[model samples]
Target: MIRNTRSGWGSISRWFHWILAAAIIGMIGFGWWVNHVPARPDRFFYRSIHADIGYLVLLLMVLRLVWRAANPTPALPADSARWTRVAAGISHAALYLITILVAVLGWAHSGAHAPDYSSFFGWFHVPQFTTPDREAARAYEDRHILFAYVLLALIAVHVIAAAWHHYIRRDRVASRMVASDAGTSR
Candidate 1:
């Protein structure tokens, strides 16, 4: 279904969740790989791809936020514990906040470090908003790394919680956000 039911997520929501999850995870690995590459001409090409993907991620994040705001999420299972619901709410909020921050920091980091200009797939250019500064770039990069770790930890918790609900609680909490078999026909 296109709209969420009381028991599960809509297809749009499921697509957004999984797509963003994959993009973010891939960007994390790409970011690390680019940093480790030897100083070669091809490294710049890889960095350009990273920057393009970062911009795409930012766009997706914005779209996801709008989608989330416009749509209703499935309600927690009726039998869920109060603490479980509360934790879910907080963790979800944190995930949103951190995702936004990570994207912004990446953009800012690029602006702060770019020697000449930032290009998006060579079709367009993203202006560097901040003046290039070695120190500031270092600081932004450090925070980006730190928050990335935090995001990773939150993802682990999210996955574990979903597994707990699915396997231990035998509830729809996990499936609702997954493929959405109408919120859990199981």
Candidate 2:
């Protein structure tokens, strides 16, 4: 089914979930690698790839938001603690917020660097919000890194929480979002 019910998320939502998960993980890795590479040619190549993927991720995030608004999320497990439920809701919201913030800040950080550093895979140019300024770029870059770390921490918590539900609680909380072909119980 394309639409979610109270029991589990639909295939569309699952696709969005998994794709965004993979993209975010990849972007994080690329972010780390691009910063560490010393060779200008290698770094430029990595940065170009990273920029394109980041743009795709931003688009996917937007589509995911629209998809979420149009679909229903699974209900919380009946036996789940109230605090756990509250934390899950807050963390999920924070994940969405942080993802958007990081993308925007990264875009600005790239744009604020000298000579208009950002482009959509080098096929076209992306406009900058700020003029070239080293200090401003540094600030944006710092915040982007900080937000990326926050995103990573949240992801770790999210994974742990899902594992807790799957193993300790023996619940379908995590299964609801996984592929149906994976034998996820409804």
Best by the lDDT measure: 2
Candidate 2 positional error at 156, Å = 0.4
1-186 in candidate 2: lDDT tens per residue?
Answer: 677776778888899999999999989988988988887856766766776777778888989999888877777877778999899999999999999899888878778777555777768887767778899889998998899999999999999999998898887788778855433444
- Identify the runs in model 2 with alpha carbons over 4 angstroms from their true place: 181-186
lDDT of candidates 1 onward, in order: 0.82, 0.83
Q: Each candidate's TM vs. the true structure?
A: 0.92, 0.91
Q: For candidate 2, give the lDDT of residue 63.
A: 93
Candidate 2 whole-model C-alpha lDDT, 0 to 1: 0.83
Tens-digit lDDT string for candidate 1 (92-126): 99988897888778778888885623788889888
Worst 10 residues of 2 by lDDT: 177-186
